[model samples]
Target chain A: MRELSITTEACDTGGCPVRVVRVSGYIDAHSFPRFEREILTLVNQGNNRLLLDLRNATYICSTALGLLMSVFRQVRHNAGDLVIAGMSEKIANIFNLLGISKLIQAFPDEEEALRCLAAAEAS
Target chain B: MTTRRRDLALMVPGEAEYLCLVRDLVTTVARKAGFPDCRIGEIEIAVDEACANIIEHAYGRRPPGEPHVGKPQAIAVRLALFPDRIEVRIRDRGRCFPPEMASSLDIAEFAASGRRRGIGSYIIRSFVDEVHHSYRPGRGNELTLVKYLAKGVPGG
Candidate 1:
């Protein structure tokens, strides 16, 4: 199994300060710590508006999903949002089955998620 | 008729890397056993949850120390590939999950709650074909998960 790699960057969405974290490879027990660390760093830095691009993500375990929910809670409590974007149908189904869709917002693409986050922040 | 069989065991320190290794191995084994892409994903998720439970409950975050108190190896994952099914057995020498905890977990309830942490065992049961647990008085606990592939698949 390959190591899970998460890349973070501040995406310039026509003036909205949104951070995009691209998670690739497998997100099982092994890579969850790194995932938690990066999300925590983003939250601690006060960058709460997040768009997680999972277009390249091959797998995500319940542990990873749990961490995402924890981060979402932290962000929401701080008046920010964590959005998931570009999840594969299979992965999306897992999220849906876990009822994550009800707790966090999801979009089909990064651009749409960014737009939604931007609009929400402006309101 | 008997199917081809492959069995191996891994003794992993309670570290994140080992968890990934287990997932990889399980996925590969499932694929080799002719599981469809969708089923492979299911097996991967189930295996991860089982292993994560062991790491968190058995080893308690940090790696086990020298002279390993109870068992020289705190955790071990065993994989057995049969013609029609793949069985993953995770063994840990830690406090067993209280019978109450095991009995109270209802998959339907957890699915409705959507709370992240408590759904592991439930999810494992829902995704796999069969899930069994045994706590031998002196031998510690073992969680066995089996996924049976559909007939048209391949390995068998």
Candidate 2:
């Protein structure tokens, strides 16, 4: 099965570590483990502040949202934070309907989300 | 016996591995039936979720990453194309699920729960126009999703 492509770049801005994971393609029940494993691995590596970029994701199923929640809970449990950015229109609609756009830390793009995470870390 | 008519049918092992195949089949059938792109995406997702639920709950399989024991089950998905709508029935010869699981989704509560487990069934119920579930005792379980096409839409 073709899984979501996960490219994680670790950035340290003024002593704050933010792991930006850019995911492309579909995120569903079958493919969510790839996304989940990446985030869990990053969290294990101490890159707690996270920015999951889904702008290029073709689709995000509700099960994938659960995967995101697992990552969110993991980051929060470790006293770190997580945010998402670059949601495609379809993904954004699903997020909006599920209240994720309102409940989670979200931004229009990676840059904005990185800035927010870094700023929060600095505070 | 649940007697009915079906236009297309496809079956896959009740494992998460074959969800894409089911989704692709749904997409092709929905496209041939003249569903709009957006609506087609919704149908694809809803069907995917239905199949997923069948794989998990019906077959009694654990979530991904957990060690699965014993043999995998099989899930059958059928489609019925009609003039005003499309109906999809997903069947599994595994354990039966509660008929009440097809209840309406509470978006607010679901989000408040951190968007956890119930999202799959919720999405299946939300995106599709109608959803229904039936249990055949020791036989199996069947979940159906329906999407109504707009009037005068081509291929209807």
Clash pairs of candidate 1?
none
Which ten-residue region of model 1 chain A has the weakest summed lDDT? A93-102
Q: Kindly list the per-residue Cα lDDT of model 2 for residues B40-97, writing each as its tens digit.
A: 7778877887777676666766777765576667889889987677889888887767
**Residue runs of model 1 more than 4 Å from their true location after superposition:** A77-79, A119-123, B1-9, B63-74, B98-116, B151-156
Task: Give, for candidate 2 chain A, the lowest lDDT window spanning 10 residues.
Answer: A89-98
Q: Model 2 segments beyond 4 Å from truth?
A: A13-16, A73-80, A116-123, B1-6, B32-34, B62-72, B99-115, B151-156
List-wise, what DockQ does each model earn?
0.39, 0.33
What CA RMSD would you report for each candidate?
A: 4.8, 5.1
Cα lDDT of model 1 by residue, B5-35, tens digit: 9997887765556677777788788888898
Shift in Å, residue A52, candidate 2: 0.8
What are the interface RMSDs of all the models?
A: 5.0, 4.1
What is residue A118's positional error in candidate 1, in angstroms? 3.8
